[model samples]
Every structure is written in structure tokens, then in C-alpha cells.
Target: DAGVTQSPTHLIKTRGQQVTLRCSPKSGHDTVSWYQQALGQGPQFIFQYYEEEERQRGNFPDRFSGHQFPNYSSELNVNALLLGDSALYLCASTAGGKGHAPAKNIQYFGAGTRLSVL
Candidate 1:
């Protein structure tokens, strides 16, 4: 079975351009979250979506947005991108619900898309 997958593993854009990143969750995963990782920095949560609704969001600006489909796949869209936006965009997937192992509750990340804004 294929695990989580992301498309166009790398992207480039001008400071004012926009970009879209895609992700398909792992088998049986019901939750998807987006994260941004700057060079040499740990991943920072962007937002999370469950049951097709945004369940939580991080400190990112309005330029960072996401959508989850009924099938649990998700997309991240950034508009009016800035040069500082250059970084790795990560997508994480995990099964939903409680009663799972604390360790099992951790999100599994995809290889991530490296975005470069010039």
C-alpha cells in the first residue's frame, strides 16, 4: 500500500506569485496537517484538517491556507508569496480518534516540497 505522497516535490516562484502543494494521506488516515520547515529549523504547524473541516491552525498568516477533501487528501495554497516563504512545505497524515498509543498519535510526514521564492 502506498503511504503518504506529495506532488512536485520542489517548486519555485517569484516573491509575489502563488503556489499550490498537494498531498495524499496514508491508507486509513483521517487527519491531515500542513507544516513549514525553514532551512535548519524544525517543522512548524500550518494547520490541520479533519472530517473536511479545519480543526486547528498555527500562527501562519492568511496567505497560508489549506483544504481537505472527503477522501482525506489535502492541499496547501499560498498566495502573494514572499521571499521569506522559501522553505520546505510538509504534509503529515495520521489516523483519527482517541484510544491509540501516545506514540501512535504522532503524525507521519511526507518527504516534503521545497519551495523557493525569489
Candidate 2:
């Protein structure tokens, strides 16, 4: 019954350096999605992965990318980061074997990796 987990609960980076964040899905879950939440805005979907392949993507630029390993864990990589990139990065998981929720399935989020770009 483990829930999603993220590493480095918080992070700080310069405007152009890169950063990598990690996520482990909940028990028995097979899908992972990434989201970015600005200071006062709702979470914005970055992308989703299932079966290790990207299933869907949002409007983010190519600077954002990710990988899901065989163990259903994931990593989010942001390169040449910008000041605006500073925000909370969330990792959400859903069990593929279960039925999708009425509202496109609820995404259970980790506390999130808070990135601060200088």
C-alpha cells in the first residue's frame, strides 16, 4: 500500500543548469504523469507514460522530458532551465488495471519536488 514517493523534497538551481527529479509509483500502479504547478496556479500536465512509452503530452516545450523504468519508477529531466521553471514538480500515478475515474481518473500526487531556479 505504498504511495508515490519523490526525492530531494526540495531543490535549487541556477538559471541555466539542469536538474533531475525522481518518482516511484504506488504499489500495483503502472502509469506515471508529471505536472508543474506555479506559485498560484493549478497543476499543469506535462506528460504521461505507460508501458515505458509516452502516452500523452501537454503543451510544454522540448526542454522537458522524462523516462519510466521497468520498475514503474520515473525521472523528470529539465535542461537549460529557465528562471520561470522554478515551481513544484509533481508525480502522479494511477493503476492501469483499475477502471478510469469518471473525471479521467484521479491523479494521486506526491508532496512534489520543489525546484528553485535562480
Candidate 3:
């Protein structure tokens, strides 16, 4: 079975442009989450989706939006992009089953799509 997959491993864009990144969830995963990782910085959670609906969101602005398909695949869209938006866009997937173990619910991130905003 395939792990999480992301398209356009790398992306380049100018300020104010928009971009969309895609991801395929891991086998049997029902939850998809997105993160932004800047160079020398840890990833910041963007949002998470389950059952084709957004379940939770982080501190990102409204410009950062996402969608999840019935198949559990997902897409992250950034609008009116800013230079600071440049970073590695990571896609994570997990079953999120009922469990008390944090480790068990852990989301695994993929190689990520590097975005460069000029």
C-alpha cells in the first residue's frame, strides 16, 4: 500500500499569486491534515479534514483553505500568496480512531511540497 503522497514536489510563485497543492492519503486513513514548514522552523498546522468536512483548523489565515474528497484525498489552496508563505507544504494522514495513546493517533507527514514565493 502507498503512504501519503503529494504532488508538485516543488513550486515557485510570485507574490499575490495563488497555488494549489494536492495530496493522497495513506491507505485506510480517514483524516487528512496540512502543515507549513518554513526553513529552519518546525511545521505549523494549517487544518485537518475528515468525512469530507473540515474538523479542525489552526492559526492560519482565511487565505489558507483546503478540501477533502470522499476518497480521503485532499488539496491545500493558498490565495493572494505572500513571500512569507514560501515553505514546505506537508500532508499528513491518520486513522484517528478512538484511542487514548497519543502515539497511536500520531499523523505521519510525507516528503512535502516545497513552495517558493518570490
Candidate whose TM-score is highest: 1
Against the reference, the lDDT scores of all candidates come to 0.90, 0.92, 0.92
* CA deviation > 4 Å runs, candidate 3: 97-104
TM-scores, all candidates, are 0.94, 0.93, 0.94
Give one digit per residue, the lDDT tens place, for model 1 in 15-69.
Answer: 8998999999988888999999999999999999999889999999999888999
* RMSD after CA superposition, every candidate: 1.3, 1.6, 1.5
Residue-wise C-alpha lDDT for candidate 3, range 1-118, written one tens digit per residue = 9999999999999999999999998888888999999999999999999898999999999999999998889999999999999999999998874345675478988899999999
Q: Write the per-residue lDDT of candidate 2 for residues 14-73, one digit (tens) a residue.
A: 988999999999887889999999999999999998989889999999999999999989
Winner on lDDT (1 vs 3):
3
Q: Tell me which residue pairs clash in candidate 3.
A: none
